[model samples]
Target: MEDNHIHSISSKSACKVTDDICLPDTNWPRLVIVGGGFAGLALVEKLKNKKVQVVLFDKNNFHQFQPLLYQVATSALEPDSIVFPFRKQFNGYKNVVFRLAVVEEIQPTSNIVRTNKGDVHYDYLVLATGTTTNFFGMDTVADNSLGMKDIRDSLNIRHMMLQNLEQAAITCDDEERDTLTNFVIVGGGPAGVEMAGALAEFCKYILPKDYPEYPSTIMNIYLIEARGELLSSMSDKASSKTLKYLEDLNVNVLLNESVSNYDGSKVITNRDNIIMAKNLIWTAGVKGQFPKGIDKKYVVRGNRIKTNPFLMVEDYKNIFAIGDIAAVITEKTPKGHPQVAQTAIQQGKYLGTSILNIIKNKPIKPFEYHDKGSLATVGKRKAVADLGKFRFGGYFAWLLWSIVHLMSISGFRNRLMVGFNWAVSYFTYEKSNRLIIRNFNKPSESKSTINSQPAVKKITIND
Candidate 1:
């Protein structure tokens, strides 16, 4: 086994090996994993020290802790606190290698992955590409609204939020100011609810102190959901509790309402209520994001690749699909498992062992998802949890949520930073990382204007 190395595959080295861009030749079977999310990471962990050459490919160099992305968007935690470098993570794994590349296509017949850099041959391939925000064919909404799917998206939301606040403070037009301050979030899922709560907290605590000129009361937070209840996947008790929690936080929970369209400055709902909001965060839905080359028949609803019981893609034995991109249709889970981190983690670990079993000519076990629980935090000291027969909410659940998330985070430094931030916010209501490093302009705005705009100077808030 050789020490793990991180490489950037070059386009010139597509089919053949070159000095600058080449994977070490080995007799061991090469396992190529596409993605650096929960599943891919878990799979790598399981494959550590195994009789396999593992190569993980991802566009980004870091594995983002997606569960806490809302915290980053709401300025509760910095981006670095939720992201871990791939190289640092797999440092001791001698059999593994990490590559920074965007996978362009999957050639299953040839057992090769075509990336932007080059094409790499593989003995077995794992598709854990994860999910991307689904705009549901609404081009206008997709163009205008911000989606919180990754660190960049979260940072965009934060920048837009602070920029909107600054604009609201300077704008003479009352309607424009209202539009700037009104935060509209589509989808009542955990992300939307958490965002609404965080924004509500910002209105209740941070705004009055930071921007005294603009009344905090003017900053309205709306959480719109087409469904009747929030946390629709959770138990009714959890959903009801989450609704109450959001309401208590002064987050306007607009149930049974769908967004018809979002023009840059206004949100038109199906219920005929027009919301003036410059910042619209869409957490409505997600669809599996996979590269081309797979048969369209294997791609099912939600853009997920259909897989058999062993987590193998339909009609393929060596290629497997896991995480949000995989729809492992079973008798019990006909629609596939919930697109959550746990499902991906478990599936990745299970498939890793299954692959080992295949290599050893042993019986491969079927993948089974263990439902640990579902949890969502609404506001400070307010959350709901559904743990099978046990259902609870409020302060205890909030504490549990915090601890679990803190522990689940990637690194020790990240855990410390996030915990410290949470403590600071809990003890004294303040968001320290609210500095707008980048001036975020509307998507329709000219790129030149965006580039020419001066960066926001740092402001020290006096106690």
Candidate 2:
């Protein structure tokens, strides 16, 4: 087969093709990747400048560093700091191209993907679409509470918190003030724990200084977990230490309790315990997110696509999945690999080489996951880590967490921005991005639903 065996519409004549996204003419096998999260980007990195022409499709053009999204939500860093443009990442990589479009459907039979912009054919397809916030089919909770799944969610949390605090200041009634100031974080996972810790810090360090009228205890931080302990995925030591860390920070750790319902202002737990809070952040669960056209038979628990050990969807040789969307089911691992950055990165890189070998008809081995340990931070100078035969917490663990995350960010400039902010906050306890530039309204309800419901009273600034 020669290089020109496959002919693509030239750049000048791309408009003539109906329902097709304009792409550079290429003879190399086109690898169409959906989503640009950890796994997809890893594959992109591995295949850059390779013989395969890669077309990366994502709704957002930037790659977000998810582990630190809590910081962004808590205003420790800006959105731009955690996001890197795909074009900037692909600079000098001639074989790679990125398109900003939402994939609406996957037509495996036609070897094409239909996006909101246009359709594009693929020689091979990979789904790294990742997961979205899972509310367990609770519409009320889904509408009222904020999720920590993306940069937008983080921004929403930040705005919700700031606006609620401002409302707390405006109210005359004590009960309404309490409802406005209290914070409820559902889920005992790493995200919820980190968010609770960060909010606790905000209440402790930033509240009294920013608002002299209110005491430091005006804001209450509650962390609710359905599980018996925090960080259930980690070892017993790590879990215990994490609980201790949050407790010391005055976070109301509610273990063995689940949120039964939330009506925008009140949190009702399964035990019938009621907590009044206007700001609720949900980090409880996530389900696979991808375009339609995937057979329901291949879908498993958590809505993930079932794939073989080689990372190929069962019965579909040319279609594959990676990252959070992929559930590689095997006897040893009945569910799937952990939906973490490490698993996704490894899978992406593995599949990169695997795809090239596949094109060349070379043999490939089964996909195997190597556990790289887990790290979760409660707040500044506090974290827990679980490594092989070694579990630890406190300052040293926090240091390890910081170093690992700093090195894991996408770009050097982003790394620098985060490192600088962390350094300033490590000593000063400062969060620089607290300005409420925009009013945030929940997607599911009217703006009035989130407003403070107490009677308004007039008080002069000096009064």
Candidate 3:
């Protein structure tokens, strides 16, 4: 059976001199959505069977489950378990088309989006480009440290970690071996905490058994945070418990200290500590990421676009911004809602309904975010959760966290695979997917190789 649902426009044809690649005529409004993250997917799901011809654009063809990316980095789960292809996800949506292209700029005056492939006109445009790793203007850190933003980054971390271990096993120099084994993670956010815990678990269970050549005691895992507490957004109880959990797992928690600089080998902090480590996983912060054409006035702190109560971008009714890239300021959320999956998902669903209301000439409702609580797991059975005033930390919280994340995953197959992996790891204490499929180099070495590639083309659907 031929798969006519998704098609790719070849690079040669995409680069042809044409005014605009012709699109199928439709009486309904054509909606162009930029991104395939949590918010964009939710919006597309809501617009299913609606009076709209939706075209979704993303550089990648898959929607990544970001919350569980750490597991991939630590080899706890394979990459396939956390990523779902867009074509498979929207196979039944006949009115929707998925394009794999890099959006260069937006021409708001003409309602056309200029991409690497070609120009695409739309009746309404939605920007859910999400956020990128923010280095806070620290060039040294940006150049030297590894980030956990995407699956590629996770795989790079995994490869670097295993490669470093392999090198440590062969090196005779004690200092070099120590640097190879030393792991420093900046930012005590959920990603950093989970990574630290996972690394510690590896040292405890897997390292001793798998790599007997190198002693596990020599390996050092450090969690650094500028703030005094971990999981600052959560309640104090949750924060304290999380700190305790990390300490119990033998992770060195550095509080109230900021990374001053990293020269690719040494991690220099504001305090007296200057640690040597080749691998530094940075999860400190993230800022809004979108293409050009949005006015500077509309962009606020953290590089986010200012959106109204209806999630429409300021000064443009037909353009909307949601997810981590949007700053929807309200009295309750003066600084905008926390950049979490729930916020994006809620806003996306609301914006979809609002678009339909606008089409029907009916009143549109404002978006209201209901806090669904927060959860963070440190080690196997050590976790913390904050639900309103109720706070809990222990094995129950870990189980609850696992169940919630498993249910939140995209497909049943992914959930089952992840559940099975967790069960196996629980009993056997092993991470089977540690193979380095591709070798990873430092950012400076890899940047030139990536820049040589041509622009991505679109994935077209048959009429």
What are the clash counts of all predictions, listed in order?
Answer: 0, 0, 1
Worst 10 residues of 2 by lDDT: 454-463
lDDT of candidate 1 over 136-220, digit per residue (tens) = 9988788888999999999999999999999999999988888888888999999998889889998899999989997788888
TM-score of 3: 0.91
Clashing pairs in 2: none
lDDT for each candidate structure: 0.86, 0.88, 0.86
Task: Report the C-alpha lDDT of model 3 over 318-395, residue by residue, as the tens digit.
Answer: 999999999998887778999999999998899999988787678988899999999999978888999888899999
Model 3 clash pairs are: 7-460
Per-residue lDDT over 316-350 for candidate 2, one digit per residue giving the tens place of the 0 to 100 score: 99999999999999998899999999999999999
Kindly provide the TM-score of model 2 when superposed on the true structure, using C-alpha atoms.
0.94
Which candidate do you rate higher for TM-score, 2 or 3? 2
Clashing pairs in 1: none
* C-alpha RMSD between model 2 and the true structure: 4.9
**TM-score-best of 1 and 2:** 2
Q: Which parts of model 3 have CA positions greater than 4 angstroms off?
A: 1-19, 444-463
Give the per-residue Cα lDDT of candidate 3 at 341: 96
